[model samples]
Target: MLKDENFIAQNDDLDQFNRKRPQFGGRFLNDESEIFQYNAWDDVEWNDEQKFLAQEKIQKNCSKLMPEEDSELLENRAEFFWDEFYATHKDGFFKDRNWLFTEFPELKRFSCSSSEEKCQNFQILEVGCGVGNTIFPILEAN
Candidate 1:
C-alpha cells in the first residue's frame, strides 16, 4: 500500500499475461511491522510439575474428538466441524496472505509469470475446507 509521496513519477514495470482473467504479481516486501526479528533463544523456565500440567492440557484439547477410540469418526467429525464453520463465515474468513511468500519461497517460484501458464505450472493440494485465502492472492494478484 506504499505510494510515492516525494512527487516522483516512477515507471512501474507492468507484467503482462494472456488469459480470461489476470494474475496478481508484485514484489514481496516488509515494512514497519517487524520491529525486531531476533530472538534471545532462552529456554522456558517452567518447573517439572508445570510442564506436565501443560502437556496434559494440550493432549486433552488435541484429543477432544476421541481420536484414540475411533479414528474414522474423528476424521469425519473434524471435517464436519470445519464445514460448519466455513458455512457460517463464508468469505468473511478469506483474506490475503501475502506473508506466505516469506515463509514458502516455492509459492512464488510456482506462480506463473504469464497468464497462459496459469494452473498448468504447478499442483496445489487443498487441505480441509480453507477459504483459499492463502493461495488465491499469490496466484491472482493484480
Candidate 2:
C-alpha cells in the first residue's frame, strides 16, 4: 500500500467565515463569440439554455458505463501512464500557477518572513502525481 501525506490547517484564533475574499483573476468571457480568444476565463455566467445544455451533456455522458476490466487495467497502470505523460510533456504542459498564492493567501502564513518571528512546524505535502506546477510556486514564494 502507498502512503500519502496530508496538510490540515487549524486556527482557533481566526474566524473562518469572516475572512476577506481574495481578488485574483479578472478575465471574463462576456461574449460567447470570443470564447476561443483565451484558453480559460475567470468568472463566467451561463445562460439558461447553456445551463440546460451542460446538464444534458452531463446526463448523456454519465449514462455510459465502462467495463470493469478496462477500468481495472487503467487503474493498475495509472502510474505508468502518468509517468509517460510527464516524460513526454515535462513541466511545459502547465504554466507555473502563480494564482495559487492569490487564491490561497493562507499558504503565505506558513513561511517565516522575519528573523524575530519563529516559524511554526508547518508542512505542505502534495500527494499523487503532477509536474509540480502547484507545489513549486508555493515553495518559491517568499
Candidate 3:
C-alpha cells in the first residue's frame, strides 16, 4: 500500500475537507469533464445522511454473513470457513480484477506512468486475494 507521507495535500477552504492529491503518478482519473471530477473516494465529501446510510449498510451486510448455528466458530476462525469454501469450490468463483490500476493508481507505477517503463521485483500482498485472480494481472502488467 502507498504510504500517506508520499501524498501532497491542498485545502483552500476552511469549512471543507482537506484533499490529498498524489504526486506519484498522473491524474488519478482519466476523465476531463467537471461533472466526473468527484468520481474517486478521496473526491467524495460524505454528509451526515450518507454516513447514516453507510452505517445501515454495514449492519445489513454483517447480519447477512453471520452464521446462526456456528456463531461461536466464527468468533475468530472466519478464515477457516473461507479456506474450506474455496478448497471445495476452487477457481470457478473469481475472475481477474482488472481495475486495480484504475482504483489504486500507485500500483500501476511502471506502465501507467509511461509506455517505455517496466517494473520488476515489486512486492505486494493483497489480502482476501482469492485464487490469486487479483495479483495475476498486476504481475503480468509488471
Candidate 4:
C-alpha cells in the first residue's frame, strides 16, 4: 500500500539523519538495565533526578572547609610527596598512553617517519610528565 511505502520512506529519512549525526563513540548507554554494566558510558544524558542529586551533592560539598595549617602543610610538602611517589613507582605506575596519537593527531603530524630525518629542533616541555609516560610515547613516535 502507499501508506506502507510512505512509512518506509520516513524510516529511511530518519536513518539517514541518525547516520549524519556526530558520534562521540560506539559505546552508548541505550538501555537503563545495562547502566551498571560499564565503567563508563559515552554520550549519556542524565535524568532530571540524577542531575538534581548531582547538584545537591556539589552544593553540600562546596561549603566544606579544610584547616589552614593542613592546607599549608600539604602545599609545603607537595614536592617532597611527588618525589617520594616517583621514587616509589620509578616509571612503572602509569601505562604508556597509545591513545595519545588518536587524541592528539598533532603528535603524529610532528613525528618523523622512518624514511624521514629525525628532528633535532623539536622541543616539548611537558609539565607534570609523571615518569615519562607521555613523553616516552612521543619520543618513540617522533
Candidate 5:
C-alpha cells in the first residue's frame, strides 16, 4: 500500500470543476493534413557509427542472446536503454516525487501501515522493483 503525506490538500485547483457556459457548441473536425504530420525515413537522422556502437554494447552486455543482425535486438536494446537511462537519472529525476503526498493530500490515504492485528507477521512483496525504488519509498513513508 502507498501512503500520501498529510500536509497536502486532497483536492487540487486543476482538478476542480468549472461550471461556466460553453461559448461554442458545434464540433469541427480538422483534416488529417492540418492535424497531423507523418515523416518518412528520409527525414530521420541516422548515425551509423553511433548505431553500431549501441548495438555492440547491447550484444556485449547481454551475451548476444539475440543475434547482432536480428531486428528484435534493436527493440530489446531500446528496453535496456530506457532501463539504464532511468536508473542513471533515478535520484535526480525522482527527487520531486518525495513530495507527492504533500502536493496532493488525497493520496495520503494510500500510505501503508503495519497491520495492528498481526504486525509481526506482515510481509510485503514487490515485483521488478529495481535498486530499492519501492523498498526505499516504503521505508521513507514508514
Candidate 6:
C-alpha cells in the first residue's frame, strides 16, 4: 500500500535502526552457571598459541621500529612499563589527540551528526585502555 519513495524511506529508517542497536557479547550471570561461564576475566587466559599469534601480529605491525629480538623484549617489557608508567601519571599522562579525524575515515560513521556537517560529535570510551595507547590513537585519528 506504500508508494515507492515511502517504502525506500522506511527501509532506510529500518537499516539505520538496526545499525544503532547495541550488541552484548558476554554470557549471562547466574547461580547455576559454571565459574568459567560467569567470570570473563578468569576464563580468558591466553594460551601459548594465542600468545604466539599476538607476537606474530606485533612483529608484523611494528616491523619498522622493532627487530625480532628487540620486539620480543619490547613486548615482554611493555606490560611492566605500562603498569609503572600509569601508576605515576594516572590520567594526566595523555593529551587528547583529536587531529586523527583526517586520517581514519571509518571513524566518521560513529559521528552523531549528519555526514554533511563538517564537525561530527562522537564519544569513544576505551576499556582497558592501558596507558591510553588505544585512546590516544583514536583521539589523534578523530
Q: Against the hidden reference, what TM-scores do the models get? A: 0.37, 0.56, 0.38, 0.55, 0.25, 0.23
Among the numbered candidates, top TM-score falls to 2
| Model 2 agreement with the true structure over 1-142: per-residue lDDT tens digits | 1111122122222224214333346667788898787777677788999999999999999999999999999999999998998899887886655455556667655755445668687767776455555776555443
Candidate 2 error regions (>4 Å): 1-22, 25-27, 31-39, 109-114, 117-129
lDDT of 2 at 12: 20
| lDDT, model 2, position 112 | 52
Residue 36, candidate 4: alpha-carbon lDDT? 92
Off by over 4 Å in 5: 1-73, 83-90, 99-119, 128-132, 140-142
lDDT score for residue 98 of model 3: 41
The residue pairs in collision within model 3 are none
Worst 10 residues of 1 by lDDT: 5-14
lDDT of each: 0.49, 0.62, 0.54, 0.63, 0.45, 0.54
User: How are the candidates ranked when ordered by lDDT, highest leading?
Assistant: 4, 2, 6, 3, 1, 5
For residue 50, what is the lDDT in candidate 2? 98
Candidate 6's TM-score: 0.23
RMSD of 4: 15.0
Best by lDDT: 4
lDDT of 1 at 119: 48
Residue-wise C-alpha lDDT for candidate 6, range 1-142, written one tens digit per residue = 4343444454455446445532234334455546565333223557999999999999898776657898798788999988898899888867664333333435434422333557656676667644456554444223
Report lDDT (Cα) of residue 136, candidate 5: 53
